[model samples]
Target: MEKIVSFIANLINTQKQFIKDLKELKNHKDIMVKDDEKLIQQFIKKKAS
Candidate 1:
């Protein structure tokens, strides 16, 4: 029983860490998309002018 509990605790900890990493990755992706859009807009403005 004790070993089972320990295993479960470890699994929960790993899952929590995975979730945190996933959130960070999503945030990073959003920032990259926004940066890319800004760059494209600037390019278009330059071309128009």
Candidate 2:
């Protein structure tokens, strides 16, 4: 599950540069529905920081 989530996050990251902020990732509620929220949140937070 982590691997799958990581892959999905990686895909999302392709557009992350356009994101412009960590808050954007936090507001993307639809992502929580498609993947593990904690995992994705952590990943995005770490990368954003």
Candidate 3:
């Protein structure tokens, strides 16, 4: 019984960490997308000029 409880606790902690990492990855992706958009716009403007 004790081992089962410990195993379950560890699983929960691992899941929480995974979720946190996923959120950070999502935020990073969003930032990258924004940066890419800015770069594209700058390139277009430069080309036009």
Candidate 4:
């Protein structure tokens, strides 16, 4: 009974940490994508000029 409770608590904690990490990763990916788009646009403008 105690062991089961402990196991469940650990699982919940792990899941929470995983969710937090996933959100951070998603945010970083979005920033990178936006930066990439801006870079591409600059490259295109330079090429055009």
Q: How much does candidate 2 score in TM-score?
A: 0.31
lDDT of 1: 0.63
Clashing pairs in 4: none
Residue runs of model 1 more than 4 Å from their true location after superposition: 29-49
lDDT of 1 at 37: 56
What are the models' TM-scores? 0.56, 0.31, 0.56, 0.56
Predictions: Cα RMSD each: 13.8, 13.0, 13.6, 13.5
Off by over 4 Å in 4: 29-49
Best by lDDT: 2
Residues 1-49 of candidate 4 have per-residue lDDT tens digits of: 9999999999999889766654554465444544645655544454478
lDDT of 1 by residue, 2-31 (tens): 999999999999889766654554465444
Provide the lowest-lDDT 10-residue window in model 2: 17-26
The CA lDDT at 4 in model 2 is 100
Which is superior by lDDT, 1 or 2? Answer: 2
Q: Which candidate model has the greater TM-score, 1 or 2?
A: 1
How many clashing residue pairs appear in each of the predictions shown?
Answer: 0, 0, 0, 0
The 0-to-1 C-alpha lDDT of every candidate, in the order given, reads 0.63, 0.65, 0.63, 0.63
